[model samples]
Target: MAWRNALTKSMQELRIHLCQTSPASAGVRDFVMANYAEIKKVDPRFPVSLRECAGAEAKLTARYDFGVEKTVSVQGASSAAVLTQLQELIQLGEKMPKSGE
Candidate 1:
């Protein structure tokens, strides 16, 4: 896939923080169910961790090479909105120059 070429060379992991049972987390939960498989299919080796707290704010955190990290809040957004944000983030990461570039 073309997206594979754009994958950040330094991206290390992805962490999803959300409340297991909360209205604000509904969209993220839906997004996960709809896209999690596709995400891993994109890169099985990339670690994606899910941390559920009863009342935690929904957020997406991506850890990149050299400990660089990016995060975005997904609170109350619909699944499509969440997907859009994720795609935008990936595009942004791809545009960022790597070390020694």
Candidate 2:
């Protein structure tokens, strides 16, 4: 019972956080979408516009845009490289930082 209550509370907090953060993220999505033409020339598979990107981001979180930006920022790099870097960051997030020497 306690665990279930804790889980419910955690989920509620997450929902609130999402609601607060989503608007800023939506703005970012709009900015990215406005630049889609330039971004698409860099990567053909990029979404067609900002609304699409925002929808995806809403489902996936800001990390999706971070990955896309990281992927596109490098010249002559494949999308796979961006995915690889994102994966590394995700893994790093799962681990604890080392103590000071």
Candidate 3:
């Protein structure tokens, strides 16, 4: 039963981490999505969408002309890491070269 005890302990730790971080991650997701909508205004040709995944994971998709698209996702163990990943995606979108540029 020693292995069983170890497994249970590991699962408990995982649960604790998720409980502590998930709410903050959700907040970050909302913040990023709101900011992304503003970014889309600058170039409506490239639209963005946000997806919430199980656990503390978030996905952002940027669709380009001609049905081309790219997705950026972050499954962070901490709130700060999630925020950083979201910010990086925004910065990258801002730097994306326009067509024929």
Clashing residue pair totals per candidate (backbone < 3 A) = 0, 0, 0
Instruction: Flag the better candidate by TM-score, 2 or 3.
Output: 3
lDDT of 1 at 76: 93
Deviating ranges (above 4 Å) for candidate 3: 1-21, 59-73, 76-83, 86-101
lDDT of each: 0.78, 0.30, 0.40
* Local accuracy of candidate 1 as per-residue lDDT tens digits, 10-95: 45677889999999999999988987787788778878899999999999887766667899999998888877777666776676
Candidate 1 versus the native: TM-score? 0.83
User: Mind giving the per-residue lDDT tens digits that candidate 3 earns over 1-101?
Assistant: 23222222211111111222365455455555455455445445432333344564444444433344455554442445554544454444445554544
Candidate 3 to native Cα RMSD, angstroms: 16.8
lDDT of 1: 0.78
In order of appearance, the predictions have TM-scores of: 0.83, 0.24, 0.36
